[model samples]
Target chain A: MAVLNMVSALNQAFGGEMERDPSVVVLGEDVGRDGGVFRVTEGLLDRFGADRVVDTPLAEMAIAGMAVGMALNGLRPVAEIQFMGFSYLTLSTMISHASRMRNRTRSGMHVPMVMRMPYGAGVKALEHHSESMEALFVQVPGLKVVVPSTPREAKGLLISSIRDPDPVVFLEPTRSYRLMKEEVEEESFTIPLGEARQVREGDDITVVGWGAMMPLIEKAVGSVGKKGIECDVLDLRTLSPMDSTAVLSSVRKTGRCVIVQEAPRNCGVAAELIARINEGALLSLEAPVERVTAPDIVVPLPQGEGHYYITPGRIENAIERVANF
Target chain B: MLIDDYDPLKKRMLQVLDQEGKVVNPSLEPVLDPDVLMRAYRTMVLARQIDDKAVILQRQGRLGAYPPNRGQEAASLGPAMAIGKDDWLVWAFRELAGLLWKGLDPLRLYLYWMGNEEGSHYPPGLKVLPAVIPVGSQLPIAVGMAYASMIRREGTVTLSYCGDGATSAGDFHEALNSAGTFRTPNVFVIQNNQWAISMPRNRQTAAPTLAQKAVAYGFPGIMVDGNDVLAMYMATQEAVGRARRGEGPTLIEAYTYRMGNHTTSDDAKKYRLEEELKEWEKRDPLVRLKAYLMNRGMLDERQEETILGEAKEETERIVVEAERFPRPTVDDVFKHTYAQMPRTLTEQLERCRRLEGGGR
Candidate 1:
């Protein structure tokens, strides 16, 4: 075991998988020599030559499209888009081709590839750098959307994603890359996709969130614990084939739920969670589900991000409202 | 090199056989095997027959909207004939001639236009991708396949086709740039069929030739007489050979004309003049190839009639086969979504079954 941050954990996963499977390759702009803009791919070029670690031209569409081709040709390609904002360029392939290759071909062919992009806002970054739009990818069928909260979750879930039989949109938390360190397994370990992890268990209310929102939800849960309003925090590691059973079970026990997200309030993952809760555990609910999310507006630039970004206070307020109701 | 000789920048297009079926460039004309030549001619004939029947079927409400490959048969078949059996063919829609040449069942093509997903389920070892409706999107995938080939030390090359309109797409430019940057074994054939729906070639880009676009991406690009099967075959053969030798990608602009509407939904008479269509008809690819074969005494009037009759019979049989193909089941719609269907999808499938009045 080794203490590592999210970036290091993900890098370890890539290294482990690439070493185990020769068909695994890493490709993206600055991924080879520059070691990625975030340096997550640092040392991979030297470790696994240029053939395995390719630095492609700065084209997001081709990066994603090429990964699909590589996957079709029996290579497990882990392609990176510089940021989530730039990831829209890839939606053309992700939607039209990557996501539907298996279904379109009726199992004749499938793209076993992973597209990784750092998402969410926190650090003062340039425009289009900080975006938490997991909802956009979740809405796309035939795609597995995964978000990892901590270093351990990042390493395990990334490995699982790389090994998955279909295309996966692996959105890493930008703010959590180095925000905290945890003792992660040095060797390969896999946390299965579509399973939720119970972070803090209680009975008063069920608090559900993912990626960058986990730490905020945990902090809120910690603050609310002092007021005797215990919370059951669920980390939705995988967003698409979400662990709704875990949420429903927890909601059934708590009878009240609070969903938190960093994305805009409209049509976000929280709304999807609320709908699932309504369908599965509506009769058990003692109070209406409360959603804590960013306002429906363009994610403000760094200067004005404080007003638009989700905070622990907002999560705590929602948890209190659900508990009191 | 053919690419060096017909530099797209010089606006010089390579033409082996002229519109009159005369050998315009004797030295550049490829000497193909007798069997290969016959197969190429047969595939082109069948494509044209299928194209005609598809339009009739759509008109009769038997099939859905279908793209016609009327005049550009040679442009699609020639490059397809040049590649090896193992080579990948990533095609945009409307490459019926190429798909047929690559061993795709005509029934699958008919089934695809008839709105069946099973149409895309190609038989094993047929290394052709399904029809990409979104223009220029398949190019990047082709590049990636070539890139993978390079990494695996596989000598396989990927040949992808796009239209004149697809050249204006960002994916087109990005695919070429990446292919050039990686020096992948790729052959990008632009079927410049003149019309992207209503937009003319002149309005697509200011570049003098679509082939020249490859020059900006650090590779050789050539313009070929698309109607001349010999020219397209010779140019693509050279490009495929260069790619196999690891000389990197080559872009070929198959300068052809869309002799028919973009799809059955379109009408060419609305935006194009009759004089233009009439002029292109005189340079029709099938007519030119047939003339060349007849001039060489390789094909006679009786043989031509027999080939046409066979094509008609085969197309008729395929239409029945496609129409009779099984309708998709609820399980078919849900099963292939994932390798292992997740619990959520399973539940949804069960729900769909329940709603359909089937409890099982």
Candidate 2:
């Protein structure tokens, strides 16, 4: 086992997979010589030659659409969109072709690729680089949305996403890329795409969160536990297929639930999860589910963003209220 | 497919066989096989008949909206016959005739227009991509396929077709830039049909010619008489061979017209005058090809009548076949979205089944 951060873990995933599968190639802006803007794809160019690690033009539409073409030609590609907000220009290609290829061609072809980008707001980044647009990717019928919160999960989930037979939108949280360290495997491994992991076990209530908000929710749950409110924390690693069974069972036992997210309140991933829970296990809930989300407004510059971020105070307060309701 | 100098500022148009059936360049002429020449003529005729029939079908409410390639047959069918079976055909919505010439079933084309997913499916090993509707979007994907061919040294050239309207799209520009930067083996056949559904060519771009834009992408571009099927075939043949030799891409702008309405839903009569329509009708692609075949004594009046009759029968038979296709299942909506069904999609399918008493 190696104690690594998210960036290093991701680098390992690219190296390990590209070594295991010769067909695997990486393409993006500055991904080759510069490693990546975030250095998540560091050392790929050195490990693999220029033919395998491509430095594409500064066109998101082409980068996105080109992946579909390469995939159709029997090559597995991992395309990076540089940043989450920058990926907006790519949604036309992603939703139109990459996601729909398998269905449109009816199994005659598929986009076996990963579209990874640093997502969610933090670190006082510039405009267009701080988007938390996971909801948009999840709406497309064909794309799978995967969010990894820890180094271990980052390496494993990324590996799985690369190997998946269809296109996967692997959204890496910019706030969590270097936020913490974890003991991840030095050998090859994959975390299943549509499964949930229970980070903490408690009986009073269940707190669900993912990506950048997971660590915050975990700390909030621990803080609430010391104050006579024990909580269950389930990290939803995969958002689209969403381990609804795990979420429902957790709520069934605790009878109370709270969801935390960095995205806005309306039409966010939290809203969808709560709907799925109420659909399946509504009677089991002893209290109305509480949602702690950013306000439905554009994330302002860092000076005005304090009111918009989901902090530990907010998550803890929501959990305490739901547990004692 | 005359290769001459192109000035971006001063747009040049190329035509070999004239409106009155005369060759412009005999010394550098491409010798045509009589059977191949007649096949090209028959393809253009059948395409026109289908376009006319599709218009009537839409009027009678028997079909969904259909885009007619009435005046641009040579722009389409010429390039369609230029490539080998090993090459790939990336299509836009208007390349229906080209796809047909490439051995695609006419019934499948109708099925897709009729809104069935099954019609979009090309059987394995065809090397043809399903038609893309978004303008200029499939260009980059075509470039990527060519890039892979270069990497594997597969020598599979790609020929992608798009309308003049697609030239204004960002993806189209991006695609060409990538192709030029990588020198990918691909050919971009731009059918400048004079209209992007009401937006005329003059309004599409300030550039004098769409062919000249290829110079910005480091490729030579040529303007051709799109209605002359012979010209398109010759141009596409040269471009395809150049691509396979790793000589890079060529942008062929086939200056054609949209004689019919843009689509069944559109009414070109509202925008353009009947006088302009008549002017283009005088330069009909099939008429010129027919005249050339007759002048060469390869076709006579009786043979021409027989060819048209066979085309009508073939089209009608395919119409019957298309109508006989069973409605696609709802499973088509879920299957192939993933290799195996996801839990969320599985839940959706179960809900759909429960709603309608279940289905395949």
Candidate 3:
């Protein structure tokens, strides 16, 4: 084990996978020589050469569409979309082709590729930079949406995603890239998708979140714990094909739930979780579930980011309210 | 090189056989085997018959809305004939002739129009992608496939088809630009069939010729008389040879006409003139090819009758077989979504099965 940041851990994942599998190729704008916009693919071009680590033309749709073709032709391609905001350009190909290739051809073809992008607010970046749009991808069928909160999860889940036989949208948390350090295993390891990890076990209430919101949820749990309010915190690693069993069981045990998200509130993943809880664990609930999310509005520019960004204070308040109720 | 000689910017169009079915460019004419020529002619005829029957089927409520490939048979089949067996063919929805030449069973095409998913399950080693409905979306996919071939040193080229209107889409430019940058073995054939639904070619772009667009992408582009099968075949052959030799991509603009409605659901008479249809009818690709074959004594009137009669019988058999194909089951809907269906999907499928009265 070695202590590393999310960027280093992910770079190790890419390097390890490419070295192990000759069929794995990396392609995106500036992914070759420049490593990546975030340097997550640093040193791959030199290590794997240009054929395996390609710097594509500055067209998101082509990058994604070409990745689909490459995947169909027996290449495991991991394409980066620079940023989540720029990823919408690839939705045309993702929704029309990559998401349906296997179903349309009835198993004759499948897109075994990954589209990686840095998402979420609180980075105070420029317009179209910090976007938490995981909900958009989660709603798309035939796609696996994985968001890794820590260095270990990022490396493990990404390797598993690259190996899976379906297209995966791996959204990296921009705020968590270099925020904290952790001791991550250097060797290849896979955290199976559709399984949630229980960060803290408690009986007062169940606090559910993922991606960039995990840090805030932990902070809220810490502050509420000081107030003698112990909470159960669950980090949902994969959004699509969600680990509903974990969430339902946790809610049933605690008899109270509070879902938090960095994305806007309307029709978000939190809403889906609440509906599922109502379906399976409603009779066990002691109070109505509470949701803490950013309002349904455009993520503001740098100066106004703090106003729209979800804070730990808001999460703590929601957690305490559910705990008391 | 045919591509360099008939540059679109120079307003030069390549033509081996003129409108009268006479060899106008003997030096550029390809010396194809007699059997190959006969097969090419037969495939074009069969494609036309299928189009006609498909239109009637749609009208008779036996098939869904179908697109007609009336006058653009040579524009599609000629390039298909030039493609090697290992080459990939990525087609837009209206390339019936090319699909037939690539060995796709007519029953599958009929089943596709009859609203069945199994129709897209092409046999192994056919090297053809299912029809892409969105305009210009398949271009980038072809480029990617070609790129993969180049990386793997597969020594295989990719041929893709689109109509004139697809040139207006951003994906067209992006795909060609990438193909040129990477110099992948790709041949982009644009069947400039004169109409995109009701919109005419003149309204689609301000460029004098659609083929000139390839110039901006740093590749050779040429226009051909799409009604002349010899020119289409010759141009594509040269382009395919260039790609195989690692000389990069080539763009061929097949200047043809849509001799039928855009689809069975469309009515060309609503916006087009009768005189225009008459002018195009005289230049039908099948007629031109047949006249040339007859002049060379390779095909006779009686032989032509036999070919048509055989195609009609085969098409009837294909229709019966396609209609009798098994319907999709509930499991099929959930099976291929993922390599292994998730528990949620399996549960949903089970619920659907129970709802359908197959309780277990």
Candidate 4:
């Protein structure tokens, strides 16, 4: 086991996959010499050379479309959109083509590619840089949206995402990239998408989080656990093909639920999760599922993000209210 | 052969053969073996016939909405012929001529307009992507494929076809920029058909020529008389060769005109002038190519009739085959999102199946 953060774990996953599959190629702005904006792809250029490790221009749409084409023509390309904020231009290609390639073609042709971008707020980033648009892509036809909560899960899920015979929008948590280190497996392993990782077990309530919100949910769990509140903390590894069984089973056992998200509250992934829970385990629930999410407004500047970002206190409070209800 | 100092704003349109059925620049003309020349002419004839048949199909309510590629046969087929079998065709809307030239089953294209997902399906190793509906979107994907080809040392060139209007898209700029910056194997042939739906070419860009925009991306951007099949073919061949030798990408703006409405849904007569349409009709791709071939003694009246007859026969047969394709199931909509249908889709598929009277 190696103590690694999300960035290193992601880099290791890239290296491991590239080594395992020659068809795997990495492309993005500064992915080669600059080693990515946060060094997430550090030292890959030297190891793999210019061919495998491509440094693309400031073109997110090209990054995505090009990756899809590469996937179309045998190469399994891993494209990096420097930040999730600039992903709007690329979304047309992703949703219209990459996401719909498999279903639209229906002739066994699929885009076996991964578009990796660091998402979310709390690191005091710029306007577009702090967005969490997981909910937007979930509705896309053939896309699998994966967001890892920790370094270990990041490595495992990425391996699986790369290997999966479909397009995946792998959202990396910018705040969590170097936030902390965890014991990650040295050998490459794919933690299949659509499977939930229940970080902590409890019988009273079910707590869910993903990406940057996982740490907040974990902190809230810690805060509540100290006061004798037992809960099952589940890290939703993949949001598209959600781990409904894990969520439904946990909600059934716990009888109370709370979903945390960095995106807007109106139509967040939390809302979808709540809908699924209501449909699948409504009778088993003792109380209504509470959602701790950002307001349905555009993300504020660094000055006001501290108030808008989901905190452990809010999650803890929501848990207590739901647990007591 | 790479135009090292191409000025995008210049009005330097490359024309190998003039409309008078004469080779204006014999030195620039490719060594057109009789067989290759005949095939090129045949493909153009087929393209026009297929497009004309589609317009009829649309009127008869047999086909869905179609953007007819009536006057732009040369622009597509020329470049489509230039690239090798290994290269990929990242096509935009209205590129049936190119797809057919590249061996995409003509019936599948007709099936595509008939609202079948299977229409986008190409045989393995065909390397032709599904027709991108969104304008200018496929350009970047072509760059990416070329990027992959270069990285793998596969020596494959990617020829992306788009209309004159696609040049204004940010992805178009991005695609050109990356290909220029990376020195990847890419050739973008913008069919400057003078109109992007209702918006004319002048409204699309302030730049004098669409090809000049390629200069901004640090690459050669050449404007070719798109109606001149030989000129377009020569330009694309040069571009393909440059890309294979790791020289760089080229943007060939095929200056042509769209002789039809944007689609079955659009009323072109309401916006476009009849005079402009008539003037462009004189430089028709098929007529020019046929006349040039006849003057060169490669095609006579009998051969011309045979070609037209064959294209008509093929178009009629493809329409019959296209209509025979079974209707797609509602269940197919839920599948193909992932490798195996995920748990959510699995449940949804079951629901849809039940709705379709599966009973279980």
Best by lDDT: 1
Q: Estimate each model's TM-score.
A: 0.99, 0.97, 0.99, 0.96
| lDDT of every model, 2 decimals | 0.93, 0.87, 0.92, 0.88
DockQ-derived CAPRI band for the predicted complex in model 3: high
- Local accuracy of candidate 3 as per-residue lDDT tens digits, A1-325: 8999999999999999999999999999999999998999999999999999999999998999899989987799999999999999899899989989999888888899999999988988889998999999999889999999999999999999999999999999999999989999989889898889999999989999999899989888899999998898999999988998999999999999999989999999999999999989999999999999999999999999888998899999998898888
Query: Which residue runs of candidate 2 sit more than 4 Å off their true CA positions?
Result: B1-9, B358-360
lDDT of 3: 0.92
Q: List the residue pairs that clash in candidate 2.
A: none
Error of 1 at B359 (Å): 7.8
Q: What lDDT score goes with residue A187 in model 3? A: 93
**Clashes in predicted model 2:** 0
Best candidate according to DockQ: 1
Model 2 agreement with the true structure over A206-262: per-residue lDDT tens digits: 889999999888888779878988888899999887788999999999899999989
User: In model 1, where do residues sit more than 4 Å from their true spots?
Assistant: B358-360
Q: Across residues B1-360, which tens digit of lDDT does each residue of candidate 2 receive?
A: 355544434777777689976777775356878888888888877877777877787788878999988888888888888888888899898876788788887777888887888777888888889989988999999988888787888887889989989999999999999999888989999999999999899998998899999988988788888988878888888888889888899899999998988888999988988999999999988888888888788999999899999889988987888788888676877777889998778888888877778454
A-chain TM-score of every model: 0.99, 0.98, 0.99, 0.98
Candidate 4: tens digits of C-alpha lDDT, residues B198-310: 99999998888988888788878898889998988988999999999998899999999999999989999999899999999999988899888999899999988998999
